[model samples]
Target: MLLITNVTAVTVDSQRRIITDAAIAVKGGRIADIGKAADLAPRHPDAELLEGHGMLALPGLIDAHAHSDQALLRGAADDLSWRPYLQEVIWPLLSRRTQEDAQISLRLCMLEMIKSGTTCFVDSIVPSHYDFDALAQAVQEMGMRGVLAKYVLPDALFGRGESPVDTGGFSGEDESLADAERGIGVWHGAAGGRLQVWLGPLVPREEPPASASPGFYRRVSRLAARHGTGITVHFAGTIDDPPFFQREFGMLPAEFARRYDLLGPNVLLINGTWFSEEEIPILAETDTRLVHSPSANMKMGEGFAKVPQMRNAGVTVALGCDAAANNNCHDMIREMKAASLLHNVVMMDPTTLTAEDALEMATIEGARAIGRRDQLGSLEVGKQADMILVDLKQPHTMPIHDPIANLVYAAHGGDVDTVIVAGQVLMQGRQVLVADEAAILEEAQERGLALLKRAGIEVAPAWPME
Candidate 1:
């Protein structure tokens, strides 16, 4: 049990309350009570007290779309376009990494996430070469909520009209499905409900012969229903995805999803960059969740997602940083700032995505996307005690007029003073307490270079070197 006072709480509650000089009490890994510091401090005198230093206590940010396997691949293919990077650096990496290398990468990514106040994340799938048990063990040690996805390979890449990827050594579809089912049986509810296993079915832009069986999605849907779990997929992400769908299905991806019963509250689509105007309403009507990754979309040079329009259309649009290989960081605070500004500029309206809206997306709406909003989103009573302390007394964040505005515009990942998940402190004063941060940093540097060598992809500095 613990007590944190002298903090301004951004609850992200139903009323979106902002409590000044607030006190929050935690017991049994849940927020037990919340009120004024003067009112609640004396009641919980025996609880462990953490000095907030008048910082802003907000719900821990959630990365809705992440790649646990790609953290070590950051900056490996800098400045390369989407197709070349996917072909040369990203796809080959699926075959090149060993299980040990994967564990190190997962730890490295978790270390960054812990520092940045990311208490929960949905790790997108990479490949089966990376071991799941080792990855789950690493996440268990860190104590953060992880939606660990089981990668189920398709018969061929669906929707891959213009850009085609090589799947030479990939496992067959039946074997992949069986392996994923085994993962759900073993690790679905592990880590005392702190971890969840979900299916990650990869969707490519190829035609019928290269695509999965016609009944593939319906089959996966039934599989997920039988397991009582959820499934995530990438859809309508690229410029060619819609064209491929038109040539194959005679409709948009959302229509195709409807045909196969894929649209639902439990399903999460990664990036809908090319989603047409008509598809936004379909997502809203079905309660389908979509993650908006502004930095990654901009980095890939993909057209801006209709984020403002989607939000206006009542879609549950949460924010994500994608992967370290693309955005080069796993900082949700930075991602929030990028999202708040990017949409405003794109819409040419300063009120497009407000500070409050962006923060809500990072907190409550993010939890909703993951189907955990009831237990994980806000700093309300009966919710999980997952929150962060932002040091607003710092030089950059000094003289804060509006806490939410400053958080979305002024703050960065380093301003996060503490991170707590399930009432357990994972990081304090920017120092990670769960693992050796220095050791993981060293291991990631070594393993990242070794992976490049193993893949025979030399990355020389553009400038001449001695």
Candidate 2:
């Protein structure tokens, strides 16, 4: 058992309370009690004490959308439009990655997330993972909670799904489904429910189909239902998605998903950058979830998503960093600031999305995205003791104004001094405890650059260097 005291707790609960001089007690991997430090100290007199004299405790941030592939290729494909960014840079770089390289990349991303106060994430794996054993092992070993989505491709259309240069992956349609099902059967509730397997289908026509029957879509939905899991797909990622869907399917993306039984409380839609104004309510009515990756959109020139409108319509919109290749960094703190400012400017309303709103997207709403709202995403008793302590004494994070506002607007990922998940301290005082940071960093740096080199890509500054 552990007790955290003398801290300010940003409890993103029903009342959105911020308790000063708060104390959070942990036992049996769950939050046991929460109250004023003075009141709780006597109750847990024998518990291991974690003092937070000048820190703020917030619910662990959740990355609703992420990619392990991009972590290895970050900064290797910068300053390119979406077209060349995909065709010329990303896909090619992905092809060069090895399975060993993948483990390193996964660790790299996990390390970054843990160091930054993210305890959970939903990763839309590219190409898809053939064997989830290694990935599952990595997650369990590192103690990070993740829903790893295997990219399920229609084998009839993409005979052999695009894969890494060295790692074997997705095959025929039936085989791919079987592989994914097998994964869920074996790993879905693995690691003491710290891991889950989700099915991912790329954006419609995003693969080489040019045309697709609803059969595959319905099959995946059924598969997910059978497994008691969820499906995540990119909805209207680009500006052309709406028109393409209309011309090809005679309906918009949300309507199409709804008809195919893909829009529901269990389904997660990424991007939603081009969901028509009419479709926003459809998303709300269906209780479908959408994740906003503002930095990724800005980097790829994908245009702004109507997040404020979606929120107003009662749609559950979460936040993510997407891929490091697109966003250059996976820190959700910076992503929150970017989201708040971006939407405000685009909507021409300074009050469009508040700092608190961005914080919720990364916290409580984020838990809602993964359908774990009750178990995680808030500092409440009986919830998983997943939390982070951000040092407010830092020079950059000073002023002692509204804690929520400062957290969303000012704190850097580096200012997160400690991270606790499942009542276990994974990182403390800027040092990781679950993995070998130095070895992982060194291996990933070399392996990542080698993958980029294998793809024949060169990364350098704009100006000449001697």
Candidate 3:
């Protein structure tokens, strides 16, 4: 048993409550209890104690949608438009990568994720030889939890009549399903039940005519319902995308998905930045969740996702970094800040997104987006012991008037001093204990340089440079 006491715990419950001078008891990798420190001190006398002075505890952050394998190409495609980057560069580079690269990429990404406030993530699938088992193995070694998706693209149609023939990498639906099955069998329940398996339709709405399977979505829904797992697919992010459904099927993108019975609890709509107002009500009524990636959407020139409207309409909104090449970083705090800023600009009201709401999206809603809300979202009793302690003594964090406000508006990953997952200490003082930080950084830099050369591009200066 372990007891973390003397911390100001912001239990992000339905009330958005905060408990001062609190202590949390962890037993058997689960939060045993949480209450006033003085009351619980004598109850758990034998448990190991962790002094949490000058700390603010909150539920572990979750990255609902992430391309974990893209960590290798961190800076390779900055300043490039999304279409050319995806077609002319990323896909080609992806075809040449190996399983080893995928695992190493996941390791590096998970480390970065941990350094940020993300204790959990949903890792999207990649094309080039996805060794799901090896990927899970690497993430587990970091004491992080994730839902590993085995992405199956029945055909490579990116909508708008673009087919796999354009890319020269097409596989049958059955073959892709077989690959998913193999991945599920290998790592679905591995890592002491810390990992979950989910079905990934790489781009459900994007398939060429010859390769497109009209009934493919129904099959995916059936599989997920049968297995009691989640189904994730990219939707409504590309402007060029919706026209395909309009021309070919005479329906909008969201309408097309709805007509095929693709909206519900099991379906997670990834990157719904292009969703129309008409689609918002459908998502709300059908109980569909969304993965909102602000930085990537902006970088790709995708317009703002109607975040305030989506939240108002009862859509479960979660934050993600998308991928390193697209967003250039896996920092959830930056994502959080982006989310708040974007909503304020779009809504023309600084109060549109509150600090508390931003924190909720990063924690509870994010966990729900990937279907892990019951176990990993909040710091409540009976949930897995996953939370981060942010040091309040940092100069930027000094004179903190409101904990949640500072966390949302000003606090960064560097302020996080401790991370606990499943009652295990993964990092202390921002130093990861289970992984080699220096070596991982070294390899990541080497791989990134190689990726830039292969993609035939020079790295652009960091975000605000000329």
Best by lDDT: 2
Which residue pairs does candidate 2 place in steric collision?
A: 95-165
lDDT of 1 by residue, 1-466 (tens): 7999899999999998999999899999999999899999889989899989898999999998998789989988778667787887887875678888889999999899999889999997845557788888889999989998887766655334432443324446677788888889998888888989998876645632456345777778888989988888877888888988888878888888888877798898888899999889999999999888889888888776898888898888888888999998999988988998888888889999899989989999999998999998899999999999999887888789999998989989989999999989999989899999999999999999999899898888889999
* Tens-digit per-residue lDDT, 268-327, candidate 3: 888877788988999998889888899998887877678899999999999888998899
Candidate 2 ranges with C-alpha deviation above 4 Å: 126-130, 159-171
Give the candidate number with the greatest TM-score: 2
* Candidate 3 residue pairs in clash (backbone atoms < 3 Å): 157-206, 157-207, 157-208
Where does model 1 exceed 4 Å of error?
157-171, 207-209
| Candidate 1 backbone overlaps, count | 9
- Candidate 1 achieves a global lDDT of 0.85
Looking at model 2, which ten-residue stretch has the lowest summed lDDT? 159-168
Q: Give the Cα RMSD of candidate 3.
A: 3.0
Better of 1 and 2 by lDDT: 2
lDDT of 1 at 259: 84
TM-score of candidate 1 against the unseen true structure: 0.96
Task: For candidate 3, report its TM-score.
Answer: 0.93
Better of 2 and 3 by TM-score: 2
Task: List per-prediction Cα lDDT, in the order shown.
Answer: 0.85, 0.86, 0.80
